[model samples]
Target: MLDQAQMRYFEGNYQACFELCLKGLEVVDENLKEKFVELAALSALKLEIPQALEFCAQSYHWHKNSYFWTLNLAKALIIQQNYAEAIKLLNAFMGVENPLKLEYLHALLRAYKGQNTYNEVENIYAILLKNNPNDLQLWLEFGEYFEFIPKKALGIYQDCYFFINQKLQALEKNTPKIEVLQTFAQDSLTARFNMQKTQKTLIENPEILNLKNFVNTILTQRIAESYLRIFESPLQEAQKAAQILYSVQDKNLQNAEFWFIFAHALEYIKDYAQAEQAYRYIFAIPNAPKNIANTAAFHLAYLLMRQERFKEGLEFYENRLAFAKNTTFSQEYYQIAKNAFLQDSKVFTNKEIFVYCEQGFGDTLMFSRVFEVLCKIAKKVLFAPQSALYPLFSAKLSKENCFANLEILDRIPQDFDFALPLTSLPLFLGLDTLEKIVTLKTPIISPTNKRKSRKIKRIGFFWHTDFALKENNTRNFSLEFFLNFLLELENVKLVSLQVGDFVLPECVENAGVGFKDWLDTYKVMENLDGVVGIDSSPAHLALICGIPTLVILQPRFDWRFGLYEAPKAKFYGENAHLFVSNPNDFSTKNTIIEKLKSIF
Candidate 1:
């Protein structure tokens, strides 16, 4: 019975082998228990069940080689999504070198992903790929990790294409030799080498053929995406990407991911009609990944929202709930957002509403304007702002109105009748529609009589913004760009709004006082004639204070700013000016300098 089970396992009949192993185990002696248990566990794993974990645990108890059994147990736990146990077991084996390290590392990759530990997943991928560049599954996993960032994924896929072709060429050249070497080997050692060589050839090894097909499919999808990264102009980028993709025969025909990228490129350029058709193409595909389909629907919703088709937009945005993985400040907030049961603004009459700040400080600053509107309707309003913005909110609102106490450590206050995130307020208030949004009041604050040296014609400049984002880093130009331009503008003093320590030429003066408090930052802006910077907290603060501001934008600017260059962003009021720079054109510097001179 045991011999039959071994034969079935070798023949790849996992279900038959699993049943036969169970029968073999029923009458197997103690000496043979470990072998039967390992086989049973492997078969159960192939069947995808908790039965593997039980059998692997039994194998671990009876096996002489503890490390092998522990590794198998970890693999079983990882398959079952019991990542904590898998992670613990993997960590135990991390420093200790063993022959099974490769298996341990791969299991660790899945465990990290299960725990949402993306940085570690990337780290492990880098290590694995460096050791074995021909590992197609490793490349696939790497590309999948960047699903949100398609351009990065495309780059990885291209690398995989290069590697796969190299491997295929090598395999093809060696195939004729493989058969001859196997038939004419002189001895057991020579025969063994020829057999290993045969197994490595693509013609003999079916796994390589399967991987080669997968690589071709991924390579086709990435061609369109890789082109989109060329940020010349919106229309130009989209057209270039589309044209390059269409040039490839059969590349665009049946590829869902290709259509998805092509649609986004069109969307970026505001070709709504073509973009919508491209998205619908992806949705029409019966075999498209659900997460990707939901994302397409999400983008379709965004298009409607951008076009001020509010009713249609809201429906699509809600459809994204099927895949929208929202991370809020708390589990309660996440649940509230996911459920979205009470999104109506009109429901909160004479009730205490707590509006917790979410996302970045720029978003919070932009949405803080809605607090006054909330105070008007709600019986009482509690403003729970980010730690950095707490001082700003306290100064803006009365002490009684602001809730500085962090409920993160304690229970969510049961006193509030309704709680909503700052970003969600626009949706609930029916302020998303263009007409309603146009009439929405711009927030203006009265100067607190705080001024820094009463500098009447001073222009505050900052080049450092959100360096953590790759896009934001591109927007941050050198200080030399400003210094070269400002050399002629002797009348206007340039005050650096950048917080970090750096040596600025005598041409520009640092603001000196670091903004430890929001009030200090407010006073500095109040004194300046205008603010000049990329998108940052200071820029947002300056706009809110009604300071004349000139914002330098990247070619692909943040969605808050319109896609194309305009004199101003209407929502932030007339004092704010926006200039979009073409990354390919160096002359944009002169244009920016001219705008800065005009604004100042």
Candidate 2:
């Protein structure tokens, strides 16, 4: 029993092992005290109990020579915010043979950070980085250290950047042999397979051509990381990182990691078309890593979703469930989404269907357009929307039932035989092509309070989006930047449609008697002559309301916004025009001003 308990502890069944250890402690032999103490401490730490420090202290006392006990004790101390004790414990290992490796060093770094010992932290970081130049954690720590001691780390940071740039240059030089490119073109496994079709399309597709140019020029991850650390704003840093990557050559198309990194960066910048191609390019190669292929397929599905290409997208999305481990979504939720499955909606005839809302508020609204179609097919339909969206959706979807609370996920209606996410509707309904999406009936949800206006054109603007999304930050601006341009316009009256963190300073005329629910927001949008904002909910709202909207796009705008000079936007309809901002080099202000100037 004791041996089994120890095995469970090593296997990371921490909570289960903790219970076993507690039960074992009552009857264990005297010689097993040290082992029990170590297991108890380790499990308690993993389970995050207050007794962890006490248990860890006892383990170290009983087994002083065991590095596991020492490291666990130090980690517990750090967790308990006992920086002094942790530093003291970590410092003791510094002089020992093969000391301060991996967890010990990681613990020591946390201790140093807790104690604000910048110099010692840098020394330790440098040591680990030198030992393992390719260690991502070490590189990330080095990058973080600059953020930690911004002013004092300037000279050191410059030297680090120079070294990293040189490393990137060397990595870039590792191009495939001439014959490899020839093989890729005609006889390589990828070229000989279905990828040959994609390769041929890429050669002629203008969108692919633009992306190929951008993808071929960017720097590697390490070089971009090193370069971006110089910028204070995370948004600017990501923008610069994307630009750096956009200028480098992917000389080694055969490199899997290289494609993954490049694809990831492209996604971050909202270059979905290119990102899709890059991800697909990875799978075309034989012997592609299972994990990478699955992840790429998952992201490719999302890229397609963003473009409203749901049928094929959901197929790929579902395919990724096998590899969907350690994600933010709960296991239960994952099982539900994974198990719900995709099929023709006609199969749900004479059946009850539960439609679940996934993703953000914007996504729910954008996809809710399909609920009416769903209700027409299923005999009984129950819709679960985000709590905040319930007020508007319930009002609009009153003919059909709607549940806002998440607790509904626990008991879903008793008779519902089929389930699907709101986003997956397009797929199951067979709305596969872009032409179908463009012609799909516009959603109708009447807003409660409509503004009665005069001759002056009502130009509405929303400046900020979710701050946590780093890519959205690139599209965001100081309200002042837009205000200055709008203030210069003589024929239009500016209205602030922005809410939450973005509504500060109250510079523009507030629309109506405040806003409530998506209905009120849409009503406000309905009265506008035009709307300007990033690729956020408000932009989607404006499109749904059939307002003339000019969407300000970052270099990597969402695929639904379509390419530059696209005749019509899939999501925003024919009334929308796009103005993509150049992040690293040019100003988007003049372009925006010109668009605003032409609006009247």
Which ranges of candidate 1 are over 4 A from the true structure? 1-216, 230-237, 244-259, 279-298, 314-345, 398-414, 442-444, 448-456, 467-475, 565-568, 583-585
Q: Highest TM-score: give the candidate number.
A: 2
lDDT agreement of model 2 with the native: 0.64
Best by lDDT: 1
Question: TM-score for model 2?
Answer: 0.62
Model 2: which residue pairs collide? 217-246, 217-247, 217-248, 218-245, 218-246, 218-247, 218-248, 219-245
TM-score list, all predictions: 0.61, 0.62
User: Over the stretch 215-260, how does candidate 1's per-residue lDDT look in tens digits?
Assistant: 5455654655655654545557567666655555264467777777
Q: Tell me the lDDT of candidate 1.
A: 0.68
Clashing pairs in 1: none
Q: Cα deviation of 373 in candidate 1 (Å)?
A: 3.6
As a whole number from 0 to 100, the lDDT of residue 596 in candidate 1 is: 71
